[model samples]
Target: MTGRVGIIGIGQSNFQPRRNDASYPDLVREAVVIAMRDAGLDFDDIQAVVYSLSPDAMVGIGNAERLGVDAVGGRNKRFLRINTGGATGISSVITAWTHVASGACDVVLTAGADKVGECGDSQTVLNKIWDPIYERSLPLGTINMLAMSAVRYAHKYGMTQEDMARVVAKNRRHASKNPHAHLRKETTIEEVMASRMVSWPVKLFDCCPQSSGGCAMVLASERYIKQRGLEAVWITGLAHSSETYYLGDRMGRGFTADHADAHALGASFRKSFRMSGIKDARKEVHVAELYAPFSNTEFHSIEAAGLADIGTSPAMLREGAFALGTNAGAVVNPSGGVLCTNAIAVTAMVRIAEAALQVWGRAGERQVKGARVGIASGNGGDHQFFGTMVVEA
Candidate 1:
């Protein structure tokens, strides 16, 4: 890195199943305006833009980012459009960080809007991500594909459905503390168990809602921050990884990574910790905003982040190890996580944004106390693509 990169501002609109009052670009502009205002900067100061948009079909608009260019005032500036499925958000932030870190720009804006709930053929669109001949015939999409992983994780680790239900109950209780969360109603473990099952172990409550919203972040070099005397959170480290397209290739005895444990994700965390000059993430990371869209996935994600070990995560979780206001472990998913509010294209960005907020002491009701170092992650494309980020106060 040529220069230190810091997050100058972050903004997220109220997420819901449908944002009917705002048009797609309207949502984009709303977030940009909030972020810019928070940064005390104008569009003219943004030297580059990274648009975080996923599948255009999700918005029923081809090349949808063309409309976003105007919304974010990319008229004559350098622009990049990123689409890494659910990873698009943080991927855009990381790309924008490069522009500033590489000395190509003093300031950059990463922004996007999503209307996932309004996509009528959502399953068809998701189903296309799989290989047409092999996986598509199984008619697999996001839910069952991840449900399969949940099953493997449960079987390998002896995690009961009630154990997973506790994950849902904890996040929903945390969601009640966040105003922008889509599902804020606190729930009990018994209630989660009663929620209709979608897949065998993945209940309706175990899954995340398809939300619609927008989010934006402003990044600047240390030089720019010093020049402006802006309060900011520094991005200490960032990394990305990709898994094999065939989920089967990632599973079983001979594979490099087991589908049950997701060892590759652990490796990604190690790479990020190396970049951050951290030797022990379990001690150094004070907060974590993991992208676990399903309840069972949260356990493995915590392990992958080094917050807990594989078989020990369920036990640690039951001991109130990863809950809000707990001193035991990095307060996991203090923003209710994707389980409570998932706006596909911007969900991962929200993860980093919330992490930054915690580090900045700006995460109001859902803030983790004394979070000096925080980590965020993004998952995309059948658990094949991953991104990890480390942010600091």
Candidate 2:
């Protein structure tokens, strides 16, 4: 693609239950150092830095980025931070891409970090983002909000809870191969069904764990890539959309109008694909790493991204269409997805990094053969915010 930006290097800390060895700033530095090494570039090569974090409440510090700038090589350089709930990670990358694409910088670094376990109750903190006058009064946690959508999906599509469990099982199975995954064990439908229920249909297994980790990536303009003689994946397309903050605004309307300006998936995906000059994403794209914290959300995400027809995702899973080596099928979440590795603040960025790794042929045993095009997505704020990006080798 013309006027394309490429990711030269990507790096992440080993996601674990707790990273006691490093403070938040140290964690960010660890990832940035790895990313620079991966790109074969040093700190002097970076021109700017874009940092991402969910909220100060989670970290017990305000302007967390300020403490992280020096570690990220942002000293005396252009630095910016982004916070958009769960979508912060991907949005941060998009911002960094803009800096390079605009010819304002030769190389830009984007990073996200969190210590979710340090917080007493992240769910309570997340609830504060809801409308207090109407929605927050219900004391609806994030799982319950997603459960409502899962229930609606089941009733409308004539599916059962078992179908959702299958999604969890598949993602967990995929995570087994990811060394950095938070949860690496495989699960069965019976096990999921037996797990403790947090909401009506959501069980402990169906939800993502509160993980502590960080991720960083290095982006370079075409000029930089050529000068360094490095192979790069082009940033083909990027698009973002946000809906009204209130959940009541989308009630009674179909899935299209829920929380964020109706189901903006179709519109957002279309814009990204068109901008990338790629037609027929289902066939052209070789891999997908979507941000789905819950099982049912994964099903709806596949449809929203045009990977399958509406109401057909469950059946596709039944047929093993998303598995690796399936004929005419694209591999989905080979890294076990968010269900297996939920690093909250860095979850969405992990999706982008995973996709880039696949294209770069650096995914090791998890690599997909002949991977050329890839897609990554993130959803935040009660499904009210969306971000999508397209990358090609």
Candidate 3:
């Protein structure tokens, strides 16, 4: 763990509903070129490649990573593909970090991309990730599953639909400054409230849009960093955990499984904080890019990350603790988060990239002042998978 691995360069495409102009490989290449250029390296300088993508069933292509090897500059180098539902992006980065930290390679390229819109009705495909028998018959999709969480949170905390709308408004406002975000228009609470409802408690605007894009990052060891004299953000610690595949399995266990999720995340955060040598996460960490495809999930993430006690995130939000430039707390999702830009497969990686940029002093207008420590998280598989990472200047 002491062998340092840092992100020297990061690049992403302009996230949008569709990208008819570029093939999937072209999208990957766009981010790769920028990342390599930013790192001041050519394809030959990379020792290995770690590519991330969701199921081939969603993209209508089998062995998709094999097709992308050339574009990712992995034609002759060691290549590995990762698939962990939505957690693929962040998990891929963690894998690459290990390759460099273990000295198996000095530099590795990590990238992910998705074309959910191009595949037609991504929801239908996502539905297939669930178990084929008992759980698949409830007409339950991602929206319905999240709706259940929204209802639970609302009843538990006395939250209203308008509160969720406020979250959308705030994230969209943040997205307006992000050129690569999928939805960049500023939104109002009323506008979000008025949006069509996908489920009882979840509205259309409350849900993340189907996005198509790619992102790439160049990771190097401490030796590589010092040799190149590159401004870098070190990956101090990383962890991932997965839950049971079926919701009923989790429920019969008396919501203990959800607590297990919290425990796993808590362990990850504790390890990362210790590794980074930070005593107070809320005080030492200046920025956070959390993956919340739904507004209420943001509250869940706040509690899971140990940033707030259970049932207190809404109060924190009302107090403006999570807002940008607030002295009381860290800035959460300054890149509009998943609420503003959800690239399906690459959403988590985007969060990692955004957090890295903030720590590297390259976030432009959205950068947090004196952002020395940052955190990024990814949730996947019907909220069953979670990954957290800590980065430091």
Candidate 4:
């Protein structure tokens, strides 16, 4: 990892509950074509390929990358698959960055897609992420885990259910500006609160949809960027961290509080900030795309990313601070975020791509004004894996 690496191209398909018009590989190609076109490169230009997804069963295919390699022009080139649960997309981009930064290739493509809706019983598939011997008997899923976190947060900070509804309302309004978002309707706090409660404080509108989509990005070295006269955004710093494997290890044994402090996510952001010379996220980082699948998770992620104090995001939301075009505070999740569209394999990568778009001045409608530096993060494996990146124009 000696040379500078940057993103030269980005592409993503319209996220939806199910893509009946396209097969899995066809869905992958939809993004690949757009990415290649954006970079002004074809399959022949991609020296290496990094593919990612959640699990083989999520898409009902074994070695799923093999089915889409030819579509991405990786059939005769170096190709590899990387998965770390929901963090697979950003991890795949990290793999591509390493390939180009290490001089293994000049141009690398990282692409992945998933149809979580097509998979039967996604919750059952997600339950397998927990340890069978210790944690599997509690009927725990991602929603249940976040529900506990939400309850603890309210107890600790006196955050009301209305506060969580405000978060959803803001994001849904933001999603209305994003054509690629899966859920793009303007919502009110009443709408959010009225939505059926899926898990106590966690209501239906508070959760992200099961989206079927694909996302891909092209990473290139400085030499390639200069050679092609390409407009790119530099990945100034990238870091990832993992918490203890078992939830019991993170929280003391027999602890009923499933609430997460997101300590690992905070640590990952601090490392990325230190590496990129970012002293203050609220000042230096103009925009952020945090991986929060549920509305309540946004508070944890916002604090972990250093965008707000541990218990202050709710107040900030009420004051119009994190709003998309506001000059009041750091704009967050302008792409509507995972709260509006969760493609699992492509969710986190879409965060990175959207940040890059902001830096490159290409994020059209959802773009934040005067956003020179942007940050993105991804969480995976029951919040065990966390990745953060700082990108600049």
Candidate 5:
């Protein structure tokens, strides 16, 4: 059970507003085929299956993983479904990693597809997650939840709406170079500022698009990797943490994690970084794939990952740090992040996948030069659930 595991293959389908041509199951198959081919393994080689699907309401189908059971070769193998709101993807990947690391399975398959574009009222469906007994009274959906966080972050720090605009412009520029990204068109700071205000400082351009796509990953034990002589990227460190369910509690202090700063989220990454043998993340980490679906959230998410000091990310970002061609030590979200493409169940999984791709040196034009260490984060449900992972080449 002490076996080491690594990500041997990764695949993602083209993300778009909708995949009208393909059913959700087809999307799963598309990604699975690509991942299997990338790993040079047959479906028979997979000993376990971890299906990553979050919020069946988004897809309007209950237990949707059932539809893709056959596609993932889970008919007779061990199978489990995972959902932790937005963190479902990485959670599922971690589950697969455990299967191999535990010596129960030499190779495990993790696959998921999301069709949030098909949901009639995505926000309403997502809002049901709030506690009707306490928090539901505020009608806090995804945007306004982070919008309030933005207000607090701005108040605590000197971040202006212009800072948020720059974040949008920078991510859009990154997305433009990534074909798998949903919002690929580059935008300017002026353009982002001019966009419609969705939730105060969180402009329409600052938000992630409702995307539909699929992603799959192949993981194997180190023994299996060596036996097969396969190329792989090691999952060096990983962990997940959570905040209190109530948004009000995260307001001031003394709660799970402060809204003004991602201390709890930082705790999660620090645990992973240490486990991965990273003593100083700011200098050791060269690339990061963060799950900041909104522009303003990226600042704290970066700080939480130890990529920058808390409350200093906005200024560092303003100076063109974290951009692709910058001299900064680390580049965050080279795949344009979830702000460019957010397929709910697969979003966090895609973060790790993008990070693995960067470490694998297969990130195409969006690749960070000489990227050796990559970290990814997944945030779910009112910022309650946070997960972090570290990968090394």
Candidate 6:
């Protein structure tokens, strides 16, 4: 997709452990109304809609998008649903972008919601993502899979317990400023380290809380934005990649064993940068909203996003390099990020929304001053699905 594809509106529902007051469709409506209001348009103006979410098992409903079609005003429009696990949100946005960029539609709405907490035994449900014969018998799910990466990261980079703790503490503090974040209280490194361990090196505090939430965005072509006199953030470049199906494929002998380095992520970032002509990511990128559900994962995510070197994130992190409101470097995860909120389906889309808000100067409390270039990414499957995008003010 080429040309100027602009995000003219963004909205999100309040993130929490549960939203008993509203049904799935209701949540979708809430976000769609807010996004439509922001864009100063109605359903009549939308030419198409892209609804996204994870698998049916996660929400315990087959064809979940059907429930939200009317909510997004997709009754008679060209409506479609997207699924790529955690990457669904961002992937949906990119799909909408292509609608206008390809001259298929002048305006499109992309929205979705997830009630991960409402689902029965979310952990048990996620285990289905693995291959039935090769990987299902191990009793593994999302947390321990990433924990393996954390252990490998620690072994490769010599990252300490305190280093991982710092990542959690920083995001917790940042979440305090984000009104829509699921977890907003400030936390200390001691608090994080003292929390019950879910897996070795991945503590309770390190994990993202399962929340019920919805997010929506309105996208338009350059002519549409100019004609409407609306403020917009441009999608300069976007790319996504998938690793091999089985996690074992990502591991081999030597330093590359365990695939802790996130080589796929690095490849995704490099492809996006090359497409966007981003030669110096460290200097040119001003803010990043990376989808790291765990503390230690942030190190690899940060490095893979092209914000730092493979082994240098921990040291840079200790120096306040990725902290919000930093004077000398990019402010990472100003919206507290996935570490503070995880609504599986909408998680990755929230990253794109937060990045766009920073670029649009609309990220009120958590805005990074003079943010020009922002980046966002999503991780899904066994780190199999990856999405990356660069947004410019």
Predicted candidate 1 versus true structure: per-residue lDDT over 1-393, tens digit per residue: 566899998989989999889999999998999999999998899999999998898988998999999999999999999998988898999999999988989999999999998898887999989888888887788888888888888778899999999999999988898888999999999999999999888999999999999999999999999989999999999998878788888776688777776666777788989999988888899999999999998999999998887778999988998899788869999999999999899999999999999999998999898899999999888887788999999
Candidate 3 TM-score versus the reference: 0.96
lDDT of 3 by residue, 153-232 (tens): 78777878887887788788888888989999999888988898889888989999888889999999999889888878
Task: Give the TM-score of each candidate.
Answer: 0.98, 0.96, 0.96, 0.96, 0.98, 0.97
lDDT of each: 0.90, 0.83, 0.82, 0.87, 0.91, 0.89
Q: Per-residue alpha-carbon lDDT of model 2 for 1-393, expressed as tens digits? A: 226699998988778777888898988888888888888988888889999887778887888888888788888888999887788899899999999988899899998788887888888987877778777777877788888888877777765778889888888877887887888899999999999998888888999887888899999989879987997888889899776565555667553465312266567778899998878878888888988898888888887778888778888888877766667667888888888877777788898999998887777767778888889988877777788898888
Worst 10 contiguous positions by lDDT, candidate 1 = 257-266
Estimate candidate 6's alpha-carbon lDDT, on a 0 to 1 scale.
0.89
Error of 2 at 115 (Å): 1.3
Tens-digit lDDT track for model 6 on 1-393? 446999998989879999999999899888989999999997899999999788877778898888888888898799999998888898999899889999999999999998898887888888888889888999888999998888889998999888989998999899999999999999999999899988897999989999998999999999888988987889998898878776676667543324687777778888989988999899999999998998988999899987888888999989988998788678889999999999999899999999999998999889899999999998888887888999999
Of 4 and 5, which scores higher on lDDT?
5
Clashes of 6: 0
Task: Give the count of colliding residue pairs in each prediction.
Answer: 0, 3, 0, 0, 0, 0
Decoy 4 TM-score against native: 0.96
lDDT tens digits, residues 1-393, model 5? 665788998989989999999998998998999999999998889999999999899999999988989878888899999998998999999999989988899999999999999998999987888888877777779999899899989998989988998888888888898989999999988998899999988999989999999999999999999999999999999999888777778765556567767766898999999899999998899999999999999999999998888899999988989999989779988899999999999999999999999998999999999999999999887788888999999
| Residue pairs with clashing backbones, model 6 | none
Candidate 4 lDDT over 1-393, as tens digits, reads 666898988999989999999999999989988998998887888899999777777898987888888777876799999898888888899889989989989999999899999998888888877888889888988998778878878887778889988888888888888888999999999999899989998999999999999999999998989988998889998898987776655455664323456888899999999989999888888899999998988988899899999988888888888888688767889988999999998899999999899888888889898788999999998888888999999
lDDT of 1: 0.90
Instruction: Give every collision pair in model 4.
Output: none
